[model samples]
Target chain A: MRLSEEQYELIEAYLNNELSAADRTSFENELQADSELMAEVTLQRDLRLGFRAIGISQALDKARAQYNANRRVEAVPADPSSKPMPVTRPLSTWQYWAAAASVVVVLGVGYFVFQQTTEQPTDLAYNETFVPVDELTKEFPRGLAPNTRQQFLDILKEYEAGNYSTAIDQLKTLPADRQTVHYRNFFLGLSYLANKQPTEAIPLLQKALATPSVALRQKAEWFLALAYVKNGQKEKALPTLKRISADKAHPFNLLAQRVLQKIN
Target chain B: MAIRPLPTFLSDQELYDALKRRDDRAYQYLYAESFPSFRHWMLTHNGSEMDAEDAFQKGMLSFLLNVETGKYQFQASTQVTTVLFEYCKRVWLTELKSARVRTKAAMPDSVDSMDTGNVVEDLERLEVVNTVQKSLSQLKDECRKLIEWFYIEELSLREIAERLGMKETSVKSKRYDCAEKLKGFYAQNAKKMGL
Candidate 1:
């Protein structure tokens, strides 16, 4: 049986130990009488255990990285001789040139290694290319119930104000009728991207690409490509970005070309 | 992100408490401190550096899971490092026995005497964890994030509301919806995995 919202909240409160002693005692008495409620509680408890396990695993991964990085730092050998060597004799001109060339080569190699290790061009490109679409509600979808339409308009205010997490939460609550589906998906996808969740953004943006409006489809395709890049799926992004770059009339043509150069 | 220095605990109890709390710094400190000796033990036990690292990670994960779940309780007599080392050693020994490497070298009597818990049961528990992880990944973005933020990150409803720009009441309702969706995914996954 589908639990009412109140029932769901009650279960959560019990699971979280947020209920009072008297209330918990009464709830336990209710569970004793209801096998279904007992089973529901067990399932909720298991789900929470699973969630906590996932959190521990993620924390362990971070710790592992930190431990490894610290080891690498410690493993680097300290130079034993800090004092400059006294010149025993004047160096020959060829020897001086050879020493100068060696210094130049060493500096060049160090700089190359540093650049290779530290530079992330695709990340730079994504940061540069992904400006959030302004005024998301400008073409507010028609035929939404007045209340629903008003709710969406309010959500757009959060979106525009850079409160993407809030926008995403409210967006998920909106009723996605046939007319509003694509619009909701597009804005939801945009909010996900703005919140640095490219993995979440990618699928929704792909769905948004099927929107009937050519202009919205173009925007969706552009954002989809950017999401792919941000998500480390550059290969998936290439075809769409190439298509955009090939069409000078496409609004994102210049931006796509620039991103392609950086990623490549 | 900047790497913070590993935190120090004044006593084994403090370290155990931190581990039970799932403190990231405690995990890091334990990992860094224990690995060198564990690596040495592994090298002497017919294992390579990679094998040592693998065994240690698996062991650490299993042991910490037990601690968080209250299967392993703190004891004043047992140093945290000693217990951690023992766990890693047991992991390597289990791997060796499974691979039949014990035939190549005499099994250490010391290790054989220790109470090494059931390896098969440990693996089964880890499998459940894997199933949960897979189910979580399959959830839609909104539901996954909401669940993670609420349950994993332990964010309060009011804190999540502030971040989402919603009222606390709305956030609470949304969390319930997301949680229900997660339960749906988990049930399907559990069935598929025969859990």
Candidate 2:
């Protein structure tokens, strides 16, 4: 039965216990008399329950995200290490060109020497298994607003089409709300890695790891580890990779174990 | 990054009030304070980290539903986390019991301590909620947004109307239409799944 506005309001008030004592008694009488009204009340009650479930679930998800964000900040520091560096002082005009020439010659010979040497463990391991995950469809939020969802899908299309830079540009334009923040950070991090911007990918991937979805966290962890390896931050990558390797049931566990063995 | 300080303890009423308001910080506080111990307990009880996560999610949904529906009364001296842990622990124990049953093995001693009341019914209710969630995901974008804004988010009709650039009457009508569509989808899925 199509409920009128007054009927809907009355039902809502009754459910919320906003009905006056006399009105509540009358409503209860009507409920007993009319089975249809009782059925409507039941439906309304169930719907409210379902909605509340969704709301709380969403809140829990956001809380998870907050937890993840906290973990990321704690785990990743601005200066991961404090290695001393040689300070460059100002030089004369002739000294600048001469220094540049010498640096170029040294780099040329260094490159040749490095090429002839045995591959570094991280380099070999990363090269053997590191491939950017390009599947963006699954990362799309199922409950985003229509316009935002379409825009995000379009951005995903860009990422899938190998337009990493274009995708990143579009991703930067999207505001990071509660619904989109996790995906935004994760895919954007991957996009940065795809574009060979590992430094840029680090923080985003770290933040993405803080998401409450276990699947998303696994994906972020795997990619984040690879990002560290690509950036030559072996010290930071090893712990994450070890965690993945230890989880025998994780999707990335076998690959992580292989990477661990090769790198070690 | 500034770290949010979590309380070492909170009364049941305080925790329930925070949860009812959907405070993320309160949730973070809850997790920080209790989950580690809960996870440790799970790990010691033949449960993996993944099992702990899954169990926690199930238990949390049940707990939050009860909190929202006023089914969980705040006791004067109860530790909220203790109650939550019991609910979650029971869920894991129940799962283990069922698995053992499936294998025709003897019941484990862990299941012996559980005083079963309405846990099975609660689990079944959560399963229905899960089914509803799936149906909601399958809803058309417009209908989903309409239903979500009006019901889930609890936005006023006038507010939604202004946001959508529609008259309040039209928004109300659309909300009803969307609700009906949602109900149709939910009903079909529930029937198919025997929810």
Candidate 3:
């Protein structure tokens, strides 16, 4: 009772609501007549749910990481001297000399390693850090007019399909009203970056960081830092990257740290 | 170091909508905002911090699954945080009941009044998710990516074709093949898990 390709496609279309009214009615009638078909539909639905759960589970992991990081930051003593100090005998002179010697050895090794390694290209760092946004996961902000929403969705389709040049063109033509400016800027910046025009991406991404949505702002910050690196403005990227890397609760903290290591 | 502020929702409905949309900020906000009080509650209820964390993860997963699958609906009377806390509390209670740790503390009368829906059934459903996840992992790299992009990412055939540098027709055929492979794996895993 294995389904053929057409049957599979029809079932998928039915589930996705992509079938026409007549087709849907016919499919429903067929499903009612066939128990196996109904079971297949149920299985497909469950499988889709499972896939979605995986995505949700990943999001939960991110949330957990952020919570733990915040807790760690909160756990740090605000004033080091406020806590009772452990009573210990003073370090012997030989113990002090040994500690000093260890520091000198470590410094020597670090200096030698620094001298031997050439600075890696920013392209390497950019490539390592820059993951394009999954356009499908994003929803258009509320308050968009129907026509404007359709236009934006079409642009996202292009972007998702890797038609970045077309997406860029479509994005530019969208009206940058207060309601739509942030959405337009973010996607356009992403499009330009994906299309290898990081110079054009920088300003748009910078504007996108002004988005009222915390999630969108976090995304913009990460991409803007990458845009700086890709545009050979490493010095400009430093402050943002350093801020992100130092903040354990930031979603992109580890990635920012890796980028810093590669570039520096 | 200044901690980053959690995202604020205008209302419980807004938070619920954000959760349904799988917004990362909402998840983080929920976790951060709910945890301190939940941890304190756990500590006072004969549970350790580790127990609290485990219950929180399992409870959050179940609550979120219910939210996404329309098993739970938003009610203006009940705040999202309250619902989340109840779910975690039920998870802890279920664990305590199973481990015979309930005798250590006198159970509060309020615990029996809370309508935390069947935690055991919710966990059973999660096992199905685990089976699907394991089956997905067993797929070959190409098939796995194709299945993920198509199903999870919801990318279209044409979009996937472009990314893979294949013709749309070929991509369609490949998708069918990959999906069949996934079904085979899923069936085996489901049987193994007695689902």
Candidate 4:
């Protein structure tokens, strides 16, 4: 008997152990002389058995979260002694971002060590004080800590102080894996523009725009948007700036919003 | 307090409930449970263990932020793992784009011989997915919920029809017709996406 769709379904149910006694007997009779029906039954049964073999959700209780066993003190560093981070970057590229990345790496390594060396206070109740002063946090944007993120900020200081040449040179000595590579590129683009070289600045700024990290991507694009304006290529920069301002959630949206107004 | 054990095959609503209840433990359980397969997927894509770890972290952060910021409105029908994996993978791509750290890591060749059944099989699966989504969009308040309960949550079709005061036969037919519509939709969209 050539199996009809119903007969095929009946046989499938039987082979799947889904049929009752009456249905199974009917399916067996239905399969008589229909070797094709028998073949399908075998194929489906084998495939289902294969699915069960791979197994699913068998290790729920046993698997451990990665951060659990690796214990280190989780406390803010006390007077980190203003040390810089070290970054181990294999140098091959001559891109300005690559140069900036090296400086950022040193600062990151310094932060990592400082974070590691911090003493964990036993008493959480000992202090809950909140005091703010411009002098207290007046460190960064002033001095570039040898192995810290401040090094990039330090370059910014040089740029802000009308010493673009020194800032450009200072960036090269940075470690290879610094977080500030984002800003380094941003500022490099800006500094190059400041020194009357928008063409050299364009690629560096473009790197910032294409940054993968959302915060950095937004920041880079925000500045690239500005850099476009500064280059007198207002047509080119306006669209880019519009993108940053359009992202209402970004921290720089307000800044981008203001800048867009001036350009338009 | 009697703590509800986090369900293994948790329905999306259950996950949303757990999430809404601010149960960190449940989220941790879900992450630990799914990590191995997800890690394997990363490896298959030529991602190092470090890459997997970083990707998972970013995914979790995005998930939590979306939840806390009320961006991820509860979709009662969607699987938590599906949402998590999708979000995680997007973050991974974003990370790869942004990190700019070049690695020689290469992805394995694409699976060439996925056991595609009858030409109708691919179309069938595609249709089911599409019909489900489309009907989901067109359905009224209750019909949508009923279908989700039937398929996604694996509820008995008889129970779904009965609960909604509909004929069981009609429910089955509607479901079939919906699936067929989806299959046709798949046939149409597949061409568009160049699948």
Candidate 3 lDDT, tens digit per residue, A1-264?
Answer: 577999989988998899999999999999999999998898777677788776776566446544433433344535444422111111111110000000101000000000111232111101111122332235357777889877877776565444555788788777799888887898888776654456677899999989998777877887787777755578998899899889997756755675675456
Report the C-alpha lDDT of model 1 over B20-128, residue by residue, as the tens digit. 9988779878876787788778878887544565567667777887898888899999998898898778877876665545357666676556565665466566656
lDDT-best of 1 and 2: 1
Off by over 4 Å in 2: A1-9, A77-264, B1-3, B7-12, B110-113
Q: What is the DockQ of candidate 3?
A: 0.14
- For candidate 4, write residues A1-264 as lDDT tens digits: 233445545654675579888877887886686777676565434323222211111111111211111111012222345221111121122111100010111000000001111133110110000001111123223244555655665665564334444666686566534445555665566555443344556788797665556655654565455445544467887776577568776645544554555334
Give a tens-digit lDDT track for model 1, residues A1-264.
457789888988998899999999999999999999998888777777677776776666556545533433333323433221222112121110000000101000000000111223211101111122233454567566788878887876665444566788898888787798898898888777655466678899899988888877887787777777755578998999899889998856755665675456
Stretch of 10 with least lDDT, candidate 4 chain A: A104-113
First chain of candidate 4, TM-score: 0.39
DockQ, per-model, please? 0.21, 0.17, 0.14, 0.04
**Can you write out model 3's per-residue Cα lDDT over B50-89, one digit (the tens) per residue?**
4555576667888898898889999999999999998888
Model 3 pairs whose backbones collide = none
Off-target runs (Cα >4 Å) in candidate 4 are A1-264, B1-144
- Winner by DockQ: 1
Q: After superposition, how far is residue B157 of candidate 3 from its true place, in Å?
A: 3.2
Best by lDDT: 3
Instruction: Give candidate 3 regions above 4 Å deviation.
Output: A73-264, B1-3, B98-117
Q: iRMS values in order, in angstroms?
A: 14.1, 16.8, 14.7, 19.4
> DockQ score for model 2, please?
0.17
Please list the residue runs of candidate 1 whose C-alpha ends up more than 4 Å from where it truly belongs after superposition. Answer: A77-264, B1-6, B46-50, B95-122
Give the candidate order by descending DockQ. 1, 2, 3, 4
